[model samples]
Target: MATPSSPFSFLDDLFNRIGERLQPPAWAVHEIQHRAVLFLNHVLQQEPEAQQRLLRQQGRVVRFQWRFVTMEMVATPAGLLDLAPAGSVPELTLTVTDESPFELARATLRGGKPSVQIIGDVQLAAEVNWLVDHVRWDVEDDLARLVGDVPAHTIANGARRVVDALRQFVGGRKPPQAGGPSTGSASTAE
Candidate 1:
């Protein structure tokens, strides 16, 4: 028996088709990569220990791959990140194994790391992992610099609450069943 498809399933199929067909322009991709490197360096600057660790691995390139996007960054002498030169071999490569953006977002909201395929230098990978475990961007501080401390605090608090609510929603929600509508258990729903 063929189960009737839900509206969401139709939308999902449409989006999947669109995503597979559309590719960002090379210039846009390059710009986004440059901006990402700058943001990473900004975060690294906030953590002196992370900088010191990265400085030890200066000149080593690390390539990150997720779906169709690839970004290669090198550790600089100043312990900041910069875009690796074209064709530069990476000392370490980390590929996110998750193919679905929704699944990745759900895992992240649940405070879990996405599955990754790691290759190359073990020490470099360890250092990268340490940085991931230790470093975080201080968005509130940046907002405070732009506005004021009190407003920043209020904004941060509001954002935190919103994130918490999203986490709860994502945690409780069931993934749609293949070939059918989602049939959540009553006990789970409540």
Candidate 2:
């Protein structure tokens, strides 16, 4: 991790420190799942500067907007951890490049996240799509404002806490009743 000397690199250093200090915990998967959904929700609320949303069936909405973005950690070819953020797309129909997307993810998960490119890999992309296809995002807030909220911070902290818990878990230390994502009890309403 780079030193937190510049404003640009401060968050990177913070994440690196967090990753080391917060090893995977028993609740890692659940927290990631929760955060992934929230991130997608946050993204959905962001519209293209000119708006790229549709009013659909039963007054529902469908948007391919690229407003809300978040990060994902993946294993690398060198066996390291890195983080990737989601990219922007004002339109719903994307080119879906196999290598560019997956390679970006692999790089980030491997701890070589590019300073210039902050986007997630397929695993993270799939998670985002799951939320977009199945859940609804709040369309009122921008990404910065949404992420700045108390509730959003709480959710992020929940994710980070659970991930920290998982490192110990994979090592055979289990926390009682950390629970799974299928119990249908989510920290936020979708």
Name the candidate that leads on TM-score: 1
Q: List lDDT for all candidates, in order.
A: 0.89, 0.40
The sequence of per-residue lDDT tens digits that candidate 1 reaches over residues 50-74 is: 9999999999999999877899999
Off-target runs (Cα >4 Å) in candidate 1 are: 1-15, 173-190
lDDT of 2 at 79: 23
| lDDT score at residue 178, model 1, on the 0-100 scale | 58
Q: Extract clashing residue pairs from model 1.
A: none
Tens-digit lDDT track of model 2 for 68-153: 22233332232222233334222222232322333444444443433232243444344335443544444323333656666666
Q: How accurate is candidate 1 locally (lDDT)?
A: 0.89
Clash count, one per candidate: 0, 15
Model 1, total clashes: 0
Indicate the worst ten consecutive residues by lDDT in candidate 1.
Answer: 4-13
Worst-scoring 10-residue span by lDDT in model 2: 49-58
